[model samples]
Target: MRALLEAAGVPMAVARSGLWRPIHPAHVLGIERALRQWGQSMAALGAVAAVRYPERAAVIDENGTTSYGELDRRVERIAAGLHADHKIVAGSKVAILCRNHRGFLEATLAASRVGAEVLFVNTEFAPPQLAAVLERHAPDLLVHDAEFAVPAGIPAVPSDLAALVASDASAAPKPESPGHITILTSGTTGTPKGAPRVPTAMGLAGLMASALGRCGLRSGDPMVIAPPLFHGLGLLTSMMAFFLGSPLVLARKFDAEAVLDQVEEHRVGVIVAVPVMLRRLLEVGPRDLPSLRVVLSGASALGASLASEFIERFGPVLCDAYGSSEVGIATIASSADLIAAPGTVGRPCLGSSVRILDDDGRPVPVGETGRIFVSSGLVFGGYSDGSSKAVVDRRMSTGDMGHLDQAGRLFIDGREDDMIVSGGENVYPVEVEECLARHPAVAEAAVVGVPDEDFGQRLVGYVVLRSPATPDELIAHVRGELARYKTPREIVVVDEFPRNATGKVLRTKFGS
Candidate 1:
């Protein structure tokens, strides 16, 4: 217990978080009070930072920078307004659908302060999708950006972040509970489902240890979060910023050039993004960011090729985070790990456990692929719709097929359903996809399995080309690297791929 707390930066700022000074006694009490009421949540993090780093810069967005003190003041008033005017109180469900900006943070923090159960809605949802989510969740109120229109008759506070902050409402009373937060899963194949969970001291402790120890992140450094705040990657990283007293930088939309500019301007020490965003940064090329020490990738698969290419250009700074919305962050692979074993996702975090289990619930030997099961302290309770993931011996299934190497490093092969048996041999599509991505002419690739009369299943490839190359030539390239059966039967070249809001390729849209 002491080790966990110490590794999580409790008791001393200099101990683990990289801050040099001591936390004042009075400020510590204030943080303690807020945390006592808010639990280990974003609301408490914001409140604690307000008292601890009052004058420190807290947020930077299109509107400009807001210090911790200023941001917290706004959060208090907005919570008060929601309580006084909107009648949103503890346990009331509130939905948020906004891009990566101050509004998203304010809405979330304010709702949390009021002890409201906050649900982060994906900003990329279409009207029908959004409407369906609202209907199912039946949140008391919807807090959304001005551009997004909600279904008729639904209560909402639309694009009034500035107004809420400016209001002179009295402070809200203390609540009975810290309240729960729901983050929707990335619905790659079907409608997104709500995964509700709250942060606990134990959960945060393990995650903090991994970030500070393995990822080399320090306290009080500026951080740029390129992904949407609604995502687990951006949301969790934003909380890390609050805990470390770092200046949090956000942009409504990802632009590679703008991200580079922010890194140089802020001398940002850390950046959090998805793999696709990292690819964009690589495409836009490198920048002189001496202060940047960590480029954290999460919320999606990071191909070995992309990981290798990124580290080669940016020095040993790329850290690949592996987890799902349900499991939170189970493991983190440092750049050194990527350099040694490019496909590895490193090891389990400080307080987490990972195991590869065969279909019969037995452990698999090292270097043998099996279903990935994880027990991160932050795992969700269940889906909002009352369905839960399959759990074996207290650990939840990650729904991914992977193997651990001799050094205890985890390497994801692909999704469990994505593995195909071709010509009596099982093949993970990621191998073919990565093989295709290695070709000089191919920029990105996605592999899908289709029914085949002779082979039972055959792989089909879809690629976005960086340079001109014939399909036959690409197939020949793959055949040279992997087994003949692992090569795609057809390579359909396309100008671009159908991706979700976070830039994940959607194989469901493709027709083989």
Candidate 2:
């Protein structure tokens, strides 16, 4: 058996070991369990890392660096404080209303340790929408930073929670498996829903390890946390970094000048930001951002022209990634992939699969447009309210429409929910928006299908003009470029677009 293994090019060490003694299956299982038990929960991971690397700076907040040891101890004490003082119990929902900061991480981990679900309220929401979330979640306890002017009944915890993490390392039971972390994701239709995910399924460790491997982020490598922790991209990416023992310098919020200063000051190597944030950064223009090695852009559909502009200014470091709350990191348009397939969302990650299907749920031929369904080990289970019946057997339709080439490169056309059928022809809003964005006068644009008697549905474009221009002139410009049917029959120029809490354009409210 050993000679046969050696003939197949098996390692000599394994062959010799097998010849000497039979390997025990139980021993392998024991090692797997040991690795798993190393730490799964955010709180537990922080605690373990704190013990393993006591001196390493775990979090760089506005105040200064907070060591892992200090962060871990703070999580414990905060958990204890919530349990003992606030009467919080297992399964109790707690609303966290704050931006990205060291306190946000501490509160999340602490709540996780006590089996409490943390409802991360979108800070951008107006008073009415915020109240709606509070009503829906019905949080047992409310915790916010000093900046939040929270109403009565929801008591504020210590904003600097790192001070309390050391009090109790042995916290109570927490659901550490699938369906623990509840993140909010709005649908193409309906209200914003809660998307729950398992730690393993979300690839909390995998994303970090992969990013670290790609970026070569070691102890000394610097990273900038540009996205807010309240969003899933920020929360999971931060957790990924924490899992792989990476150091990150946190920005209190996304600001172009501040981000540039942070990269220069900390020598930041990696940065993950949205297209809007990148647009703002580019608006400021590159002035010797010497330390940046990699930039990951996601959270919205990226324009090919915009991406090329960014690459021209900042070298070939910017990578466009694609994913949603229901599905974790789906496709990553890596730097190389961008070069090969200029506008593709790239291939699936380490253990994920993608299926592009037609309207009838059958797989479409390569190069045919279809709804993008993803199946992956990293896929989240379902929404928090259990309302999502469409997601089944680890498969989720991202509500986005796209096509995959024979080479498996995914090309997103636009959102499936936002498709407009005019004069028996289908039009994708993203395609229209992309064309509009190419216009020098158009700063931003959104296309939505409106109700129509003759054509079933008509395309109406909402635009934010950069330079002064009339709606008729914009429509005429589009008509000159696109097919007459593809051009928006009606165009309305607005100062700004109506966006959801996470900066996504809301089309349902258009013309209302």
How many clashes show up per model? 0, 4
CA deviation > 4 Å runs, candidate 2: 1-39, 155-158, 162-179, 205-220, 419-512
**Could you tell me which 10 consecutive residues in candidate 2 have the lowest summed lDDT?**
11-20
Tell me how candidate 1 scores on lDDT: 0.82
Candidate 2, clashing residue pairs? 73-165, 73-166, 74-165, 75-165
Candidate-wise lDDT, in order: 0.82, 0.68
What are the C-alpha RMSDs, in order, of all predicted structures? 10.1, 11.2
Could you tell me the lDDT of residue 393 within candidate 1?
93
Worst 10 residues of 1 by lDDT: 7-16
Model 2 lDDT per residue over 1-512, tens place: 22333343433333222232443676345434423532355555565456545667788868798887777667767887777667666667777887788878878878876767777776655454456667776778667777656655555665675444444534544444411667765643435578765464235433443343333344435567787777767776776566445567886777888888888887777787876677778888657977787888776666576677788888888877677767777777766677678788777664567888877788889999988888765676667776663553457887778999878988888666665655333466776787788888999999988755335457899999889878788887777555465689888888788789999988888877
* Clashing residue pairs, backbone N/CA/C < 3 A, model 1: none
